[model samples]
Target chain A: MLDNLQLLFVWAPVMNVQMILDGVFVGAVFALSAYGLALVWGVMNVKNLAQGDFVIMGGYIAYALFHPLHGMGLPTWVIIPILIVVAMAMMFVFGHIVYQLIIKRVIDQDMFTSLLATFGLSLLMQQVINLIFGPEVQIIDSELPILTAFDSFVTIPTVKIVSLVMAMALAVVVVIFMKTSRTGQAIRATAQDPRAARVLGIDTDRVYAFTFSLNAAICGAAGVLVSMIWVIQPFYGIVYSVRSFCDGGGAGQFAGGDRDGVRPRSY
Target chain B: MKFKSLKTMVVSAAVVASVSMAGSAMAKVEGDTITLGSSISLTGKYATNGLHTTRGYDYAIKVINEAGGVKVGGKTYKLAVKYYDDESTPARGAQLAERLIQQDGVEFMLGPYSSGMTKAIAPVSEKFGVPMVEAEGASRSLFTQGYKYLFAVLSTSEQYLSTTIELAAQTTDNPSEIKVAMAFENDPFSLDVREGVVDAAKKYGMKIVIDDKLPADLSDMSATLTKVKALRPDVLIVSGHSKGAATAARQLEEMKVSVPIIGMTHCEAAKIQEKFPKAAQGIMCATQWVEGIPKRDSMFGSASDWNEGFKAEYPSYSSVPYQSAQASAAVLVWKEAFEAANSFDKDAVRDAISAIEMETFYGDIKFSAAGNNIAKPMFMRQIDANGNYNLVVTADDMQFPRKAGY
Candidate 1:
C-alpha cells in the first residue's frame, strides 16, 4: 500500500493524472447508470435489480449490430454512434414492453414485490444472453488511436474521451428533457405524488411508463459506452447493478426536487 | 413436533432408498455400456470452457465407440458420459457429484471445468470411492492432497506462467534486475498460477514491482494498470481464466500499458485475438495443446488431426482451446483404463488409471502418485500480427518487451 502511494505521489506523480482521467471516464458511465436507477427508484419506488441486465442487453444490441456493418468495412465512428442510437431506441421499446408486462403489474405493490420481480427478470435475461451469445466475453473495438502525454505514461483511448463527452452531452439532454418537457414535468409530478398527479388531470399510468422507459434508454446508452470501453459478458450485469444501487441511494435524494443530490458515484 | 418431523424424514428416507435401489439397477457398467458421470460448468462463469470440455468428451466418445468400443472382460462396451450442469458453482458441483454417484448410480467420474469446481467434486468422489479422470482442474495444491481416486490429465497450473519468468530472465543481462508485475484472480486456479509466477520470480531473484488481485468481477483493471504505468515492470502476468484474460487484454490496450513481456492464460477461450486484434499482438499465451504438436494416438491420429476433427465438430471455434484437447485425453484415459482393468469394478479401474503410461494426441499421459500428468509440457504461444499463435520454445522465437499497444 505504501509502495503504491509512493508511486502515485512521489515516484511518479504524473501517473495520478492517468488515474484521475480513468476515474472520470469510469465515472461518466456510472453517472448514466446511477441516473437511470435513480429515476426508477425515485419515480416509482421500485428497486430494479434487472437494471444491469438491461445495460448488458443493450450492449448485446450494439454487438449484434456491429458484425454485419463491420464486414462491410464501415468506419467505427459511424458504426458506433449508429449502434448507440439504435440500442437506445430499441431498449426504449423493450422497456415499454417490460413496463406493460412486469413493472406495470408490480407498480402498485410493495418494494419487495418489484425487487423480486426485477431479480427474476435479471436471471432470465442473463440466461437468455448466455444462450444467444454462448458466454464469450465481447467488446466493440472502436479502433481509435490512443492519445498519450508525459512521454507515453498517461495514455487515454480516444473512445473513452469520446464516451465521456457523449455522456456529458447525454446528461445535459436528459436534464433538459426532465426540466423543460411537459411529459417530463408530468413524470416528475407523478413521482412526487401519484394520487395528486392523477387527480390534477394527469394520466399517472402513462407518466410512469414513460419514466421507466426513459430510464431504460439511459441504461442502454450507458451500455453502449461500456461496450466501447470495457468488455461485456453474459453474467457481468450484477456488478453494474451493485454499483448503481450505491449511486441510486443518492438518486433518492435527487428525486425529491433536489438536483444538488445528484453526484458522481464515489467508488 | 420434532418426533413427528423425524417420522416424516424416516418415511421419506425409506422412499428415497427404494427409488435409488431401482436407479442402482443400472450399474456403472450395464448392458455393454460404461456410464461416466460429470458435473461440468455447462452454464455460469465457466460455461465457455465447460462447453469446450463437453465437446471434447463427446468427440472422444464418438471416436472410441467407432473404434470397436472398449474391450473389457471379453466384451466390448460403448463409453458414454452423463453430465449435469454445475452452473460453475463449487457447492453445486459437490451436490451434483453426490447425486451422480448415489442417485444416478455412477461409479466413474469426469472432472468439472475449473480448479475450484474440481476441488469441491474431488472430496465427494473420494468419499464415494468413485474414480475421476479430470482434464481441466490443474491447481498444484490439488496434487498435494494425496487423492488416490482423482487423476488429472493436464499439466498443473503453476507451470502456466512461471515459465514466462524464465523467458523474462533470459531477456535481460542480469536476471535479478528484472521486475515482475502480476495480477491474478484470488480464485483457486489463478492463485496457484500466481504462486508459480512468484516461485519463478524468486528463482531468478527478480523484483516483483506490483502484485495485485483484482476484484472477482474483473470488469476493470485500471487501478493496477495505473501502478504499472508509474512503475514500469519488465514483465506483466495475469491469470483469471477467460474473463480476466479478456479484461486484461482490453484494459491494457485502453490504458496503453507497454510492458515488454505480457503473459496471460485463456487467450483462446476468451478469443482475445479476434476481440482486440490490435491489443492481442505480442501476448504470450500459455497453452496446454496447440494444433501442430508432435504427438499422436491411435484413437485421434495426431494433435493437428484432433484439431481438424474438433473444428469440424464445433464450427464456431476458429481456434480450439487446450481445455478441450485435454478433455478428449481424459476420456481416452477412461477408455484405456477400462480396457486395462478389464472389469466393471471401480477400484480395479482406479488402479488401472494409476498404473497406465500412454501416448495421446494431447501429449504423453502418465500420472504421478499425486495424480497429475508428469510427461506433458505447457506451451507458450505469442499472438502474431495476423492473430495467429506462433509457438515460442525459447526467448529467441519470441518478441521480448512487446510493442506498446498505444
Candidate 2:
C-alpha cells in the first residue's frame, strides 16, 4: 500500500493541471497591466511615462473603497466596480489636463521630450501617492478562503480567480468600445495620419484628447485587477512601467500611410 | 656677516619642524584611542537595521568613555570609530573597506550585516593585514577563508539551526525519528540555515516532509501554510527575516496550523512581536543577545535595563535587532584593544584585539586562533504566551542544549 501510494504521487496527472492553472493565474495579472500600456500606445502614439503610477493610483482607490468604505455598508464585491469607475473618471480628467497643458506643446517634437515629460509625470505622481498613503504596503481583500484540491497539489487563491475574470471582462469591454464607438474611430484615423485625418472630417485635437482619456481608463481597469491579489505601494509604478516598455506589444504602423494608434513599441 | 645670518635661518627652520612634529603626535594617540573602521550599510534597504546599530555603537561608546575607556599598558585611551555606508551593495562595501584601510588607517575592522557584502569586503582585510571582527554575517566560508585576519563573532547559521533542531528532538516523543518541514528565503543566510537543518535532520534520521523557498516580496503566506498543514510535520523550521517570520506565523494561526515555528536570525528583532502580536507568541529563535539573559554575564547593564534604555532613547525604533547589539559589543572590543596596544600601530592593535577576552554587555567574548571573534554567546529565546520574548536558555545554563538547535 505504501509503495502504491508513493507511485501514485509520482505519476499524478493532476499535478500538471495544477501547475498550468497557477501559471495562468499569475500570467493574467501580467497581461492585464500590459493591456493598459498597450491601449494608451494604441490610441495616442504617445507612451504615457506615468502609466505605472496610474496603475498604483487605481490600486489605492480600490484599497480605500474595499477597506475603509466597507464600514459604511458597501459590499466587498461591489467595491471593485465602483473603484474601476472612479479610477477611470479621475484618470480621464487627468489625461485631458496633461495633454492640453503639456502634451499638445510637444506633440510634434522628438520622442525624447514625450518620454522625459511622461517619466517626470510618473515620478511626480509616485511622490504624491507616497505623501498621501505613506510608505507601508496595503492590499484589497474580501476575506475569502483559498481554493485547493488533490491534497494541496492544486492551490488557487480566490482573489486571483476573481481578478482573472474581472480583467478579461474589462478587456472585452474596452475592445468592443474601440471598435463600435464614433470617437474611437476618429482617434484611430488621427493616429494613422494627422494631416490626412484633418482633411477628412476628423478633429485631430479632439482625437488626441479622446485617445489619452481612453488609455487612462484602461489603466484604471488594470489597477482594479491588480489590487485583488498583490500588495500595492507607490514604488511599484516604476517596475510596472519598465515591464510594459520591455514587452512592447501595443502600438504599431498601419497600411493607410498612418501610425497605428495601437503601436505599443514604436512610440 | 654672511655665516651669522645663514646660521640664524637654519635654527629657525629647525625650531619650526620640531614644533609641527610635536603637534601631529599630540593630536593622534599611538595606542590609546583604538581606531576601528566599519564598512556597514547605513543607507539603503538595510538602512533600518544600520540606523539601530549606530545607536548600539553610541551606547557602548558612551559607557566605555564614562568609565575612562580601556586601561592597558599603564595608559587609557578612548575608542575612535570611522564608518562608511556601503548602501547594501557588495561593490560599495568593498570600496569602503579599501578606503577605511588605505586612507582612514583603521587598525582593525568590523564586518557588515549581510553575508554577500561582507564577502565582497573580505579581501580588503587580508590585503591590509587588519584583523576583522565579524559580528553579523554568518557565512561559514568567511571564517573558513583560511586568512589569519578574518574572525567571526557570531556562530554560523548551520550551527544555530542545528542546535535548535537538537532541542526540538528532545521535546518530541520519538527522539530518533521525526518529520520536519523547512521554509526560508533564497538568500545566503537563510540558505545556510536551511542546509544545516537538512543535514542535522538527516543525521538524526528525521524525514524532511516539505522544503520550499518563500518569495522575497511575499506578503501573504496562507497558501504556503496550507501546504505545511497538509505535510503535518512534527516541527516547522522557518528561515527568514522579521516580516517573513511574522507572515508565516500569521498564516499558520489563520489556517489553524499547530506546528511550532523554529525561526532563523531574522525573527530575533523586537518588531516581530509588535508586527504579529498574537502569531509571534511561542515561536523560537536563536541570537547572540537577549534581554532576559542574566545580568552578570551581559554587557548592557542588565538585559532588561539595556532594552529599557533603547526604548526610552528611540521610542519609534523597534526592539533591539541582535546585529545592533553585536555592534555595541564591537565598540567595547575596540576600546579594550586600543588600551592594550598603547600605540596606533595597526599590527600592535590587531594583536591586542586578538588577545582580548572580557565580559562585555553581550557576554564573554574573545578572538579565536583564526581571528574570528569568539565573543558572540548564544541564547535560545522564545516568544511567550503573552507575546513577549524571554531568554529560555543561556550559554551558561546547564540545561541549555549546546550541540545545535535544541
List runs of model 2 lying over 4 Å from the truth: A1-25, A39-263, B1-37, B42-48, B51-55, B58-85, B100-108, B173-176, B214-230, B242-265, B268-272, B277-282, B295-299, B375-377, B390-406
After superposition, which runs of candidate 1 have C-alpha atoms over 4 Å from their true positions?
A: A72-74, A252-267, B1-18, B404-406
* Number of clashes recorded per candidate: 2, 35
Among incorrect, acceptable, medium and high, the docking class of model 2 is incorrect
lDDT per residue, candidate 1, B1-406, as tens digits? Answer: 9999999999999998899898887658788888999999877889888988999999999989998999988888899999999989999999999999988899999999999999999999999899999999999889888889999999999999887998988887899999889998999999999999999999989999999998879888889988987788989999999999999988888777888899999999999888888789999999988889989999999999999998998898888899999999999999999889988788999999999899899999999999999999999999988889999988999987687444
CA shift at B56, candidate 2, in angstroms? 3.5
Query: What proportion of the real contacts between chains A and B does each prediction keep?
Result: 0.81, 0.02
lDDT of 1 by residue, A1-267 (tens): 998888888998998898899889988898788888888877777889999988998889988888898888998878877887898999999999999999999988987899899999998899999999878788887788889899988888899988998888888888777778898788777777779889999998898798789889988999999988898888889988988887776644543445422222222
Please give the lDDT score at residue B6 for candidate 1: 100
Q: Interface RMSD of the predictions, in order shown?
A: 1.2, 5.9
Q: What is the Cα-based TM-score of model 1?
A: 0.94
